[model samples]
Every structure is written in structure tokens, then in C-alpha cells.
Target: MCWQFPLLGIVVDFGHYFVHRAMHSKFWYEHIHYVHHSLNDGGPLTAYYSHPLDFLLGITAPVVLGWWTIHGDLKAFLVYVFLAQVGALYIHSGQSWLGNKWHYQHHAKLKRVYGLFGISDFCLK
Candidate 1:
């Protein structure tokens, strides 16, 4: 929540970013990513409303990583899950800069916006 934990945050961020990039790739998009594109005018109700491939990449990857590396600490796992949900809410709300709309611009102009949220744009761009 604080974004203060260095190691876990870094690992999770990197994993989410990279995995998300793979999902946005031409191969994946040609098949699954577009299902989400159908909701460009999306809102709060649209959150988690993703295609099956999108859901697998965004949600399953974190759980798999936790199972593999975190030794099954339910607390840490739940925290990560919470943060992910928060991030998704903020990202998909069609807003980027808290109040201003700069971030959401990518959603309209850039087809992929890199990842589920806009976090991967810096790398995926």
C-alpha cells in the first residue's frame, strides 16, 4: 500500500510488467487482447471484465508467482492481491493523473496502453 517495500514491489512490478507485455504482443492480440478493446468507453463496472487470456495473464501470474516464491504466506499474497485490485481500479477509471486526464489519453490514442493498467508503457513503448 505504501509502495515502500523495495524487493517485493520490484519483483511484482517487473513480473507484472513483463508478463503484461507478452500479453500485448502481436501474437496474443491477434487472438485475445481485442476482447477488452470492445470496452474502450469502460468504467468502474468494466473492471475485471476482461477476456479469458487477459484474465489469465493479469490475475493468474501473480498467484503463480506467490505459490512459487513466497512460500505461501497468505498475508503477503492477500496484500499483493489488494494492491493489484486498487491499481486496476485507478487505471481503468479512464483517468491517469488522479484528477486530470493525461493518463487516460493513452487509452484512447494508444491501442494497447502497454499493460492492464498503464504501468508497462514505459517499458513496452
Candidate 2:
């Protein structure tokens, strides 16, 4: 069913939140995630301008977690990938989603708010 997409999205959100928070640590932030952070202003292009490792660990790893959880459904996973891309572009554009201007705040302040959906922001932070 279409149900798994939402479940997968939630899984990815939490996973990404933790990975992103870790990326903000002293070493990783300066050496890796800083590439994304340095690209301030939260433009659409900012979404794609992360360090290779930052993209791998911060984005792909969590997506893989969700895909693995679902036991590897290629078609479904591809759909999730597309949606995640759209989300990345949108959030990086400084637009609010579900009441949170996520990447905008993240880029502007270089502080908290790491999750895609804001549940993790409220619950975890």
C-alpha cells in the first residue's frame, strides 16, 4: 500500500535529524558539514552543495535505513528519493513547511532544527 511511504519518511526524518545534529559537532561541522552550512542564504542551489561525505552520511545513510527497513523496494524507494529531492529544494529555498522554515533557520542561525518534519524539533529539542 501507500502507507509505507509515510512510515519510511518518518524513519528517515529521525535518522536525518540525528545525523545532521552530529554533523554540527566541532570536527564534522568544520571539516565536512560546513560546506553546506557555509552556503548560507538557503537557496535552492544550497540543497545540492554539500560535501560528498556530508551528502553520503547526512542524506544517503538515513534514506538507506528506511529502505532497509522496508526490505528493499526499488520502485517505492525511488519515489521516496524524488519526494525527498523536492523537499530538499523547497526547504533550502527558505520556504516554510508545516510551519517551520527549517533549512532557512538552520542556515541563518547555524543552530538547532535538524529534522525534515518538525516533530523531531519539538520532541527532541
Error of 1 at 57 (Å): 1.8
User: What are the per-residue Cα lDDT tens digits for candidate 1 across 28-124?
Assistant: 7667766765577857546677787677876677556734564555566667677767866776786656652533554466444444334445565
Residue 48 shift from truth in candidate 2, angstroms: 0.9
- The candidate scoring highest on lDDT is 2
Model 1, global lDDT:
0.60
My TM-score estimates for the predictions, one after another, are: 0.68, 0.89
Which residue pairs in candidate 1 have backbone atoms (N, alpha carbon, C) closer than 3 angstroms, thus clashing?
Answer: none
Cα misplacement distance, residue 29 of candidate 2 (Å)? 0.5
- Give me the runs in candidate 1 sitting further than 4 Å from their true place: 1-6, 70-72, 95-103, 111-125
Residues forming the 10-long window of minimal summed lDDT in candidate 2: 97-106
Candidate 1 has its poorest 10 consecutive residues by lDDT at 1-10
